[model samples]
Target: MQFSANLGFLWKELSLPDAIRAAKAAGFHAVECHFPYDTPAAEVKAALEETGLKMLGLNTIPGDVAGGEFGLCALPGREVDARAAIDQAVAYAAEIGAGAIHVMAGKAKGVEAQKMFVSKLRYACKQAAPHGITILIEPLNTYDVPGYFMTTSDHAEQIIELVDEPNIKLMFDCYHMQLMQGDLSHAIERLLPKIGHIQFASVPDRGAPDHGEVNYAHIFKVIEGLGYKAPVGAEYKPTGSTEETLDWLKDYL
Candidate 1:
């Protein structure tokens, strides 16, 4: 089982290039980020090349964060905006050679909302496919982002089915799953095929996985047993300094 440091959370103290190098130094097989739009894509690409590590994935731009747009994919009357975001993400992913892009659905619900989400996701999948990039839809727990559209693995699956796009897949985040519900092992087993990538953090508190309520060691074993070859995303916040907390990765390394 390989691992990717989520630079969005893991190495905030460093610039994009330095963060990529730090992740490589820490023995991560690959790296992922939330957003790289602010940093020049060429610079990030250079870092990835220098470190010889793959950039597994990144998130689509969250529209108007201050205006309460965590994601625009599921919002009503935002078709043009949503498509623009998708195009931007695709361009950025291509520039950096990222394999996947997580399309955020923001806080939306109900029948109309679901319909809009399906439409936006379909468009995203179609746009991303030609770039050879996979489109991921994650289910965020209410505890973290109340009213977020995708809140459970089943919810994500339902959306994926409705969208009916080959490029569409789930970004199965263990921290949110543990918060929204339990049964992580069974969920992973059943939803393995739909999952594009997986992320984890401490349950009840988004901290390092080592002290989490979830048994990561056993979970890692199950993932391996289930035959998932993709790198697991370490998308956790450090309880202390990020460097000092890496003792947990000694076994992984």
Candidate 2:
């Protein structure tokens, strides 16, 4: 039951390279991030090499964040922007030796959005295939990201099927799925085949896993029993300093 620190939430105060070192020092087996575009890939690669930590994955740039755009891939008339973001993410992931890229399907709905999402994902997969990088699509809970295009595991599965790309898979995030719908044990079993990566955070408040309604210990057992060998992503927000909230690590370690 190895763990990957999600630097996007774990070490907000440090640079990405420093965060990678911090994750290593904290004993995380690997590291991941939400966005690492601002940092030079060489520096990130150097840090990963120095720490000997695999970069599990990273997300595409959220389009127009200040204007409230969570993603662009599903938005109508944004094909150019969507594709550009995909290219950028894939290129960065390739340079940093990341295993996957989460192509965000921003706020949208209807058949057109689905069509757009599928098209963009197919494009993303094509670009990433050459680099052996997997494309991940996560179903974000609407409570935290209202109006998000992908909000249910079923919906994400449908999109994955539609894309029909072997390299594309679901980012089965436990926190969002539990918020949208409970039944974690069954969900993991049912979706295991399509899951490329799994992430966990305490439910209800999106904090450290120790206080969550979800019993991650049991969940981890279920996942391991199901033959998942990838390091599970620890993508929770710490309630205090990142180190202070690491008490939960003792249980998992």
Return the TM-score for each candidate structure. 0.97, 0.99
- Candidate 2: regions farther than 4 A off: none
Candidate 1, superposed: residue stretches over 4 Å from native: none
Model 1: colliding residue pairs: none
Number of clashing residue pairs, candidate 1:
0
Q: State each model's CA lDDT, in order.
A: 0.90, 0.94
lDDT: which candidate is best? 2
Candidate 2 global CA lDDT score: 0.94
- The alpha-carbon RMSD values of the candidates against the true structure, listed in the order shown, are 1.0, 0.7
For model 2, name the residue pairs that clash: none
lDDT of 2 by residue, 89-171 (tens): 99999999999999999999999999999999999999999999999999999888999999999999899989999999999
